[model samples]
Target: MNEVYFPYFDPDFDKLPERINGPTCRVCIDNESMDDCTVVKVDSVNKQGLLLEVVQVLTDLNLIISKSYISSDAVWFMDVFHVKDEHGNKLTDQKVINYIKQAIGTTRETHNSAKAKTYANMVFSPEPNNNNEHTVIEMSGTDRPGLFSELSAALADLHCNVVEAHAWSHNDRLACIAYISDQSTHTPIEDPNRLASIEDHLTTVLRATITPTPTTNQPNQQEAKTADFLGGEGAVTNVERRLHQLMHSVRDFEGPPSRTASLPTTPSDSESDEEAGMKTTVKIESCDEKGYSIVNINCKDRPRLMFDTVCTLTDMQYVIFHASINSDGGYAFQEYFIRHLDGCAMSTECEKERVIKCLEAAIERRVCEGVRLELCADNRVGLLSDITRVLRENGLTVVRADVETQGEKAINAFYVRDMSGNKVDMEFIESMKKEMGPIALQVKNDTIRPSSPERSRFSLSHMLKASGSLITLLLSSNPCKYS
Candidate 1:
């Protein structure tokens, strides 16, 4: 039997004492048979977000993946990617190969330890020439780990197919230009609605990359109140305004709480054990010589866990250099090498402690709060808006939402909390279920009625009335017709 050893950064291990065999990552280049591209083969233990990480590394190295094959059996993953450098030439550099090997071999516990500063401001414009060519997207922002990955992931999520992409970083600022088209039509996205949705989602991802997470050692009532305010408002306009305010509210807090005060107390040993089992732990340490920080996280795995963690780090303004990710059984273990975008280590001991607490709180809040409602319905325009309206009317605050279309069906998931920035109690949950039950049935039975022409006119009138100035102007333009 082969003994498998997990490589961890043990501060106490002073010297190399013994050799232990374990599961190892393998990366090799094959150039003997391939002519147009370089073939890279990778074998490793499979984990969440592994493929995305690998693609990110390749993208950072300015390589293009022309063709790829991926296979995994729940435990192990083997992949082969046919790639080429920017000049469309095979990779022949031994040093680059070594770097790739090191990048893939090192676990997240010890990767991404270098400091590089980057800043980005994004501008999105649509080009519609009626010829179905391409749409160009431009972004400039602070360069950090997984930035490219985030952009690519957003594009993928929005069903945009990338045709060409170029990115460059200098003096800590990064700029990217991409040419993309609609995945379904293979044409430039001409629909205003689809383009707006794409822009909205991409903007969210890009903004997260540049925003810094607020460091709060102790929960400030003001900040919590602000979050609650934003969380409570379900109206689109109010939510948007409060969210803008919440983004600027994070600031460094004064000092750490007293040790006893910082730690949560348990009533009994058995209950304490149960609570510990459900808790999430996030650790941050300095890799001074490597000029980066190391973040180790352990928690129960859930949907979009990787995206949530990366988004949090990016929002906190820390750059990830390298990472190893794994999820097994029901738990997830992630290691990240990170540094502040300013290329400085965490300023104070309290800041480090604050990072840990903030991340733990984020994960806990995500896991414990919000009822998840999954809805499957026939794909229809305006369906999402209707569903959201229902939720808003029911006093449910949508903390998170994901909507995807599969063939003729739409699968939507929403994480909702009550108005008070807390989990939905049983009563609320039951109420929500009762209300959503009919909506779901209507969707399944295709009984949803379309808006009548009179209803449409009435809706337009309502919209105009809500905008007092617009209504006044319209009435003035045609006073006799209105009267």
Candidate 2:
């Protein structure tokens, strides 16, 4: 008999045997048949995180996906994505295609997985004077899993409206360009302070890092510290084991796949209408098993919706062990198996109600409100600080921000509101545009700073204020990112 080992009990346990063998995943790119775009097709065994993993690889390659079709039977999955390079041309490189195939074909071991290291570099700038009324944001960085999704969530958090976007990846580098507008004004952003906030926030997101805390103590404290660490670790392990047992119990109760084969072949009339409208709905219910809850969500599909939902759950301090997601024809259906972050189940009525209300609010906030704007210009140190100062002087509030820099050029987006919590009017927007015109021109021209006494004093003060403001903004904006 084959020996089965659990990683929770033995940290050095070997992973379970692979279910599929002999090159189960396949990928191919067709450029000749598709006139303006490239068609990339993938076939692989069905498994958790399979779709997300494939997307991460494509995003790293700097390939823009214009359209995608995803289908999965119980045993196998197939996907076809219509794509293009940043320049909107079909892919011509064979080596790049092979790299994608290899990435998707390889099977990942489940245990002792290590996080990939990523380095982020960015630029911030303002769009050039043109008849077009939108600003542009661009970004390039080392690609990692969920990079695109994190970018989308950052943009949504900033209240920036995405007017148009293009993204591509080659090897380990990913690049993206987006044309956006202020959510309040529905025009290009002119307030410098708001732009600065957007740049700083996005830069922080791109360069975010996680480091494990080291345990150190004096002689008197060593014993206590060691005991505490071991106790906490043991508690976590027990909770995880219990959660896994509960999942298995529920699945067993549901019976084998063949048991559902005798069910109805088609949905009723009412069910069809509900699915057709594609209205957003969130449902939370207690699992019959102890220490678990089931979260069911049905909604209109949009970019990064999955990431947004997952982010919200994490913010609410929930641990998710199992999740299934399906999106088809602009509608998304998702189910999550969850418990409190501390491993306790939702046993109280009030807890369940709070979960429902909070989730609904999170979804509603993203879908509604805010004006979007975009900025493109040459990036410089302290540029974000200068821009944010201007916005504060004008009494504008930043609702959302997304910033990206590639080489020396910077492109950014911000969704903002006025002091009164309302969309900005045209007159205010025009005034901002006039004030920002000279700044953009100077940055583009690389004008030398005047060396007068007054100029030196102003520069010193500006640096101090920038440092303080950056710290304050990071601490206050979107606590969920840190949590």
Candidate 3:
């Protein structure tokens, strides 16, 4: 018996496997064909944003798309992705396989259109009448020092326990989504008055800018006071995807680079982009003959290059009629033939410039800023609030953060910088490690970026905090880089 037809993964897609399917999208998982990875093929009728959904599902599952062949020509869209687990291993885990099957495979539900059958890639229908476990808070505001700190403090003062949060800042704009619950009841704060209070409190904090230390709330026009709340069932939401959507909604990329966004010395995406003396370059040109606008991007190769590009295009109401994506010599080359939803190509310099800026913003938003500090401690009430307080004390500003709980463990990560948007000192990093515990922290030197750095597990001497124990930390730098 030939070992299952699964293929080996390529660093980036080289060639798509040959496959044929009917009009409805049918996903086939082949394990015996390639040597190193799982070959996932989806054949179906083409739609404008289907690829974005499919990519989201795969990436959200934490699977890496090492290679792919995507085509959406005529009425058919076909894609073949060579995928691997985070460890670059073929996915042999049954649980992971089942998730893939349930998410975007032939086992998925399919419905018929008038002309052809198509599958509902993912509907995300909200649950009906379930008691929400947490209340969700979403905001897109100005990027400033101690912003996350002040916000976390406000939540703590209000007796709100933050269960999970994901935030990102680019070009002086901040977009965040957090899931919080009442500290006592540990349930969603569904009261209308309480929600309004949170809105007002957060709005006040957003307007306050810091000079050395925040002594008072000062009027800041650059800040955005956009805050809204809903049921916490959104806790299961996609963090990274939602961050991208929220950032776009704020039009964060439309303005000239602010001091927060223009700091080149900080250990951020911009620094890495300029590393090796190369930068991500985006160009847009009109293809008058084809009635399309052609977008070309050349950047250092990393995972999710396609996702970032496609996500931006989809959100901007641009339709990708055809695209060619590939990696060569440690670089990613992407070309998209796109048009507006109105079926017209970009006709003005303004439109082209806007697309270019937005696409560039999309690429940089995911890049790590300052340093990344990962915490693996026991989950408890006010864990996040305490952590942010310590960072603020050390004059650290968080540009990006991802907080989560896995069972009893609080798996948290913060990408932080100094108040003036500079890299953190090594002295402070050591101080944090010492404060956390003996061998409580692990720092990896990141030379080239991965999709995102994985949390370093302190397995040998797991000095994790126990329940109800308060933890404090001061963080600086993206300490974990792919070597």
Clashes in each model (backbone N, CA, C under 3 Å)? Answer: 14, 37, 21
Per residue, candidate 2 scores C-alpha lDDT tens digits across 212-268 of 235533121100000011112131111111212222222221222233322222332
TM-score ranking of the models: 3, 2, 1
Per-residue lDDT tens digits of candidate 3, residues 93-134?
776565565556431233110111011111222122222566
Error of 1 at 394 (Å): 2.6
Output candidate 1 Cα RMSD. Answer: 20.6
At residue 290, give the lDDT of candidate 2. 51
Residue 234 of model 3, lDDT score = 25
* Candidate 3 segments whose C-alpha is farther than 4 A from its true place: 1-23, 106-131, 210-237, 255-257, 260-262, 265-274, 446-483
In terms of lDDT, model 1 sits at 0.49
Candidate 1 local lDDT, 362-405, one digit each (tens): 45433323355555555443444445554554455443433444
User: lDDT (CA) for every model shown?
Assistant: 0.49, 0.47, 0.66
* Error in Å for residue 75 of model 1: 29
Model 3 poorest ten-residue lDDT run: 111-120
Alpha-carbon lDDT of model 3: 0.66
Indicate the TM-score of model 2: 0.40
Whole-structure CA lDDT of model 2: 0.47
